[model samples]
Structures are given as C-alpha cells and as structure tokens.
Target: MNIKNRLTKLEQIIRPQQTPLVMIKFEDDWSPEQQQQIDAAEAQGRMILKVVFVGGKQDDNA
Candidate 1:
C-alpha cells in the first residue's frame, strides 16, 4: 500500500489514548535534505506526526 493508505490504516487501529510511533529505518546513508523533510512534517502539530527509531523488538502493552 501507499504511504497515505498505510497511515490511514494505522489510524484506524490506533486509539485516542494510544500513541503510535513511526520509525524510519535507513540502511544506507541519509542526506540533510531528507532529514529536513521529516523535521518539517513533525513540527506541524501534536498527533500530526509520531516518529521514533526501533532497533529490535517493540512493546505493544501501552
């Protein structure tokens, strides 16, 4: 699915009190331009963006 569709699906599964974090895993190197885009999107408003990095396992007991 596309990014928008994936995001919508995530929203449907997530609850009001639950906060879902988006982790952008990059295998290769990342450029400053790409980082700027992510930053701009996150600076919009609360619940507008929830990005985080996950190394291995994730907890879903929140």
Candidate 2:
C-alpha cells in the first residue's frame, strides 16, 4: 500500500531462489541412453523442459 511496503513486496517477489538445472529437450523420441540421462537429472532435482514441434503434423513425425 505504502512506498516502503510496495518496495519490500517487490524485493521479496524478485528475490533469487534455488536455481534448478534446466534440461531442454526438442520434439522427438529419446533413445535409451538419453532417457537414462533424463531420469538421472530428475533424481538430482533438475527440471526437465520439453518443446513441441509446431510446424505441421507431418513434420512433427519427420
């Protein structure tokens, strides 16, 4: 509500937290070895982010 309170709240919101390792994967099938790597990352508290193919239906499988 006040200036001080607003700044405090903003600071709290933007405060740095525990940064998790992000694993970005493209839109495709993963081999057995790759899947194991993903599983290992999850076990170590890493975050896995997947991306989907948005070009076309036919191209998605290609």
Candidate 3:
C-alpha cells in the first residue's frame, strides 16, 4: 500500500536470473562429433529449462 512496502516487494520479486544463450554455428568444417556434443548439451538444458523446438524437433536420441 505504501511506497516503501512496494519497493520491498519489488526487491524480493525482482532477483536477477542468469540466462544462457547457447548456440552452435554449422560451418562447412562441422562434424558429427560436434553435433553429438551439442545434442548432449541441449539434452541437459532441456532438464533445466522447458525448451521448445519451433523450427525442428529435439533429438530424441540425445
């Protein structure tokens, strides 16, 4: 109701979150091994974040 109370609530609710922007560049020199590594990382991320694949489906084999 008061400014001080609102500021306190905001401070409690507005904690910083670390968001990772994971990416892989598929170049002409890319290999299956690199893809495998990316897949493993993405699989781990799926457990931590509710990742959704809009362009293509996630590798079930990962």
Q: In order, what lDDT does every prediction score?
A: 0.56, 0.68, 0.58
* lDDT value, residue 47 of candidate 2: 69
Writing each residue's lDDT as its tens digit, candidate 3 over 1-62 gives 99999988897689543355344445544368765655776665532232334468789999
Worst 10 residues of 3 by lDDT: 45-54
Clashes of each: 0, 0, 0
lDDT of 1: 0.56
Error of 1 at 14 (Å): 23
Query: TM-score of the candidate numbered 1?
Result: 0.28
Estimate the TM-score of every prediction: 0.28, 0.39, 0.29
Residue-wise C-alpha lDDT for candidate 2, range 1-62, written one tens digit per residue: 89999988888789744455444456367667768877887887666665545555576556
**What residue pairs are clashing in model 3?**
none
Best candidate, TM-score-wise? Answer: 2
The collision pairs in model 1 are none
Arrange candidates by lDDT, highest first: which order? 2, 3, 1
Better of 1 and 3 by TM-score: 3
